[model samples]
Target: MDLRALTLLAGANSSGKSSVMQPLLLLKQTLHEDRYDPGPLKLDGPNVVFTDAGQFISQVAVGQRPRFEVSLGVGKDRGRLLYEPSAAGVTLSETGVSVGQAPEIIMRDGSVVSARETAVLLELPGLEAEGKNSIASRHGIAHEIPLVPWVSIAVVDGVLLKGSVEFPAVGWKTHLSNDLMRLIHLGGHRGNPSRRYPRSVSSSDLRPGVFHEQAAGVIAHWKQHDPASLDALQSAMRTVGLGWSIEPVDLDATAIDLRIGRTRETSRAARDLVSIADVGFGVSQSLPVLVALIDAKPGQLVYIEQPEIHLHPRAQVGVADLIVEASRRGARVVIETHSEIILTRIQYHVAKGTLPPKDVLVHWFACDPKTGDTTVTAVEPDAAGAFGDWPVDFAEVGERVDREYIEAAWKRQSGEAG
Candidate 1:
């Protein structure tokens, strides 16, 4: 995904949307939990949890292993892995790591090969890696065993993992790790309002979790340490039509709560009047999303599920405004939404010439009932706010509903007349 592009992922239920995102999330979860090196893949963690690799494998491709590929920075860095599903966890069969710095993997013996060919060369004796998170082993020629045991190579730091390549890296690091580490996720029980939140458990913590359990703390961090960022946060909140400015109140040293009140322009008093819990449920649900988007720095990826949840139809337009504005501000946004109003507003931006059509993409996913496979149809808005394909599933559903309703009404009217 382009760092500045606004991409929307939408589709029928269980049409493999989550499956596409889970691999990156798995990488994030694995790095987050340091208990094990987790050679190639992590089966369970906070973002996504699973007991067995078979749970992640495709049912149709029964004989094949559960494999995944990752490319970030527009394929500047990429990796591919094939793992054997096990009862306890998955084991990697072959792995490949490559980066864009030199466009080639430099070997210890001065033989340079294209990074793209690493996967095909995994079984053969070749160059190994050196340095921290690096591995070098020649099975027969060097009489060495595989360093990572399950996998051939794993690269976390592209530059740092560089040594003389004889074998691949041995650690759970990757060039994409930094991007994934900085990603912002807004989800879970954030819609559930509470009167107060804990100040913080860790001062250095950044991720707010799916429920945004760390949201209030992050807000307060900006308020105290980075007032300029807090201003941006407040500005973004106002843009979302929340009207009330955000203020963090300290109940004590250990507890904190957020308050929202109209600004001087909207109210006579600039003082915050009510806690976040006192607002409408829609406001509470939208708060975390706006926070996540606003908090995202330039080039930071923000993934939000159903951002328009619990919002009134009209208010969803504000969500569109936020999405467009975030992309313009250089924050990469990936929104998985089912709201027509939200999508329409974004389309309107393209139609109005306010946003470039090339910068906006809508991907519609559909599932084949018989085969259980998924396909993606992508489109970008034109000057008329028209995408080449139906951007949301509800459009067809609404038409079918209208047709069914009219048919039933006609049958009932004929019977009455007879």
Candidate 2:
């Protein structure tokens, strides 16, 4: 749930790892200019496609009208909005809004105060003023807002049942733009390699393409203007054991050939470059991931799904190095994966003090098949890099497979002896 650094989303097949990530993508697609006037939420888009609202709202949940909240936070400050499915998209209103200009609103001992003259009580929309104490707990903490000229003094009695600010709070917008808006998603299949990938110019400096269609052009961009960055990307490919260094050759004014060459074991033949299509699927699927991680600026978010897919076990472990490298470079890395090889290699780095355990987060998700409710648990690792709270289900299948193999081998040996 901490999207600031290295986070691993691991769980059962239907346990909602991707579900937690969807909201971020939902926000990304909404901001994407490619989709004409994508509303507050684009239900079906390139980042994540959905035909109906039912895919989002669960029937098993017992709420009269279930809604999902997309929360934004930076450091200790936070803002959240709740939305329900509306037609092909979603609908949301300004729930509770509080604006404080003096600085930050401080909350302590069930009393809220500000050193400055003004404190805006978050007024929840549509709720009539009634009980004060009972309604307080549902509200978000006193959030810091941008300096605005207009404000009136107000107070609510209850614990603040999820209030929304009226102006949408410029501070939250800036924070979102810095984090989720700048996020690069290398999820799902990155597409098959080709002889020439059409070049694309990115629309905004803040937002990269959610589908990552600009990766080839980005490589080409770096080659012409930022050779140092391109070198870093090539270094990353080696770190991931992909070993094939990338060369961007402009085919014409509108296209480029992303050639791959082997330079890991330097030789005369290593200098020869071939079309990316000549390499197998593994390199193609992972090229975007390396590109995102290496090219991301500090404080940007980069999310990848199954970073180890279509790779040998050794190469999978090398991906751990790349993830750690990207994180160390000040880019946040969020990965949804089932690759135990990559996970264990991360642990190895932590144990060797190459990475701090505090910098890494592992979330284990499990869903109740009958109820369809999902629960997430943080699997914490000790200083020794041992996950003491590792779930039984996580290890169960592996142990069972090992036991079955041993038993089968013993039976075969006994039959041969007889």
Q: What Cα-based lDDT does every candidate model obtain? A: 0.64, 0.67
Each model's TM-score, in the order given? 0.76, 0.79
lDDT by residue for model 1 over 350-382, one digit each (tens)?
Answer: 888888988888777899999888888787777
Please, what are the lDDT tens digits per residue for candidate 2 over residues 35-77?
3555446677778888776788666447577667666566544
Give the CA lDDT, 0 to 100, for residue 222 in model 2: 87
Question: Could you say which candidate leads in lDDT?
Answer: 2
Overall local distance difference test of candidate 1: 0.64
C-alpha lDDT (0 to 100) for residue 355 of candidate 1: 84
Go through the candidates in order and give the clash count of each.
11, 17
